[model samples]
Target: MTKLVKPVIDQVWLLRWWHRHQAQRLNREADAIRNGLLQDLFAVRRQLELLPGSGGLAAVEHLYQALDALGNRLSSPYLHDSLPLAIQQALADWPPQVPTRAELPSHWPAEPVEHTLLLLAVLNHLGQALAAQPSLPQVCAVSLTAGSDGQRLTIAANYASAVPPALLELDQSEAWRAYLATFDLFSQGRASSAHGATTLRWAFVW
Candidate 1:
């Protein structure tokens, strides 16, 4: 394997907007990204028009400049980084596609243990944040309420602030590992033994 480029701390997916500037480059390379190119362009144009004229326009313009800089620095998510340039070109334009039974790629990414843990940590962090705002209504946890009660809560079991039950069983959570497994990496890799809703709010970065 080539040396893994250390990931930039701040990462953002550009979604369909990036292609507008590279429409021809994308169409010539990744048809999957280009398959519905015209439609996506229209959608982005619509969004730009909807941009508010006051502070929002300036904020969004600045956002584009920042993303352009990030794109120059970071090409893609770490998981997709290792693909051959040919594949990278293909993925650059990967919009959703309909697949014939035989067309699906034999290899695809399954949610790995680490990624799952990270997602859990994020959910846990969000849950805690929502939990703090009583006006937002109680966002309960599946591991807490079994996700069956129709309590009209704001969040889904797909994401919550509690450490996911699936991740809580790791053999020896080295602090942050446990928290990240719950979807809240607020402390990055430092909040080793935190508990309750404040896990992220008071995370120790040491």
Candidate 2:
């Protein structure tokens, strides 16, 4: 019995290949979705009561709002930038764009809920309603803090309350409807769906 052996000449590592494909980070089409659709939804948070500004929320504030709205107090809206390829592509096909730090022309989703959670969580976590204070995480934005909680997710600041009308319309679009349909939180709640006994219950204020 004989075993064949090949000599390793200047072995190349996985890091080299990883960095090679990571060259182009920005996806203009994804950027278009964010600037076009994601930011606009920022204004919708104004409709929420007892939280913060009712006029409109800035990009950074919207980021926080999106987080809380998704039901997880501890999660990273900034991580949306590094989402799996499949989730990215699902968002790209979402008709309207999603405002995100990572902008990609095409990406797919490992789980549709992951993409939706990223989108909704960012806006829900918005703290204030001002645009002057730009805290929204961008593509280059990475983990500046070790924790992903209230004080951890953001530092204190005031955000502008100017409404971006164009973005809101997309939120109401049938396409957005399709997008939201992919997530469960946005789903109509079932009496049995409560998150255990400790879960805070709310009375709808109509």
Candidate 3:
């Protein structure tokens, strides 16, 4: 009987290879879904828009509005060269009840597309989580700062009663970290809550 042995580097190399393949596959699928599917949906929407008035014209208009909203959500958001403006656009649709305050700098350079997208996703997810909570926070403060090494986003919320459990769970989820790793963007997030107040902060380095 004999046993086979391999260096630890072999395992590391294999993991890296597997991850690379997975990333490539994900990118391909995302591209196909975004471009191919969206194009078809838009074509249908255009046809619906051109239809003459009929018994279902009202229904058709409603369908068109639904399709338009879907298209807006599915399509990529444009990022302006002014990072502050881009961030503001991303937060424009945030929940009004919570009263968010964004402290974004006016002059920072535009971030990488991946960075921009990830920021949007995180913010949107947070907004959804907050909206689902029965008790809304008094205020939600979001601040973006650029240091010599990197940039940071700090989100703090003050709830007059208690911090929502869902927010804590979402903060601990691995999805955000996985997204960062997939995009090869270094990021760190910290969450803390006490006395009906909570803060989550994420910093990114290029």
Ranked by TM-score from best down, the candidates are 3, 2, 1
Best-performing candidate as measured by TM-score: 3
lDDT of 1 by residue, 155-185 (tens): 2222234444333333143543544343323
- Predicted candidate 3 versus true structure: per-residue lDDT over 1-206, tens digit per residue: 89888657765456656644553454455455556765665576567667775355566557656654454343233432555665676567777766788898877876644445556666777677677777777788788887775666667776666677776676566874555454342223332322334444444444
- For candidate 3, the lDDT comes to 0.59
Better candidate number, 2 or 3, judged by lDDT: 3
The Cα local distance difference test for each model comes to 0.33, 0.32, 0.59
lDDT of 2 by residue, 126-205 (tens): 21211222232111111112223211111121113422343234335564444334222322311111122222111110
TM-score of 1: 0.18
Which 10-residue window in model 1 sums to the lowest lDDT? Answer: 95-104
Q: Is candidate 2 or candidate 3 better by TM-score?
A: 3
Where is model 1 more than 4 Å wrong at Cα? 1-110, 136-206
TM-score of each: 0.18, 0.20, 0.56
| Candidate 1 vs 2: which has more lDDT | 1
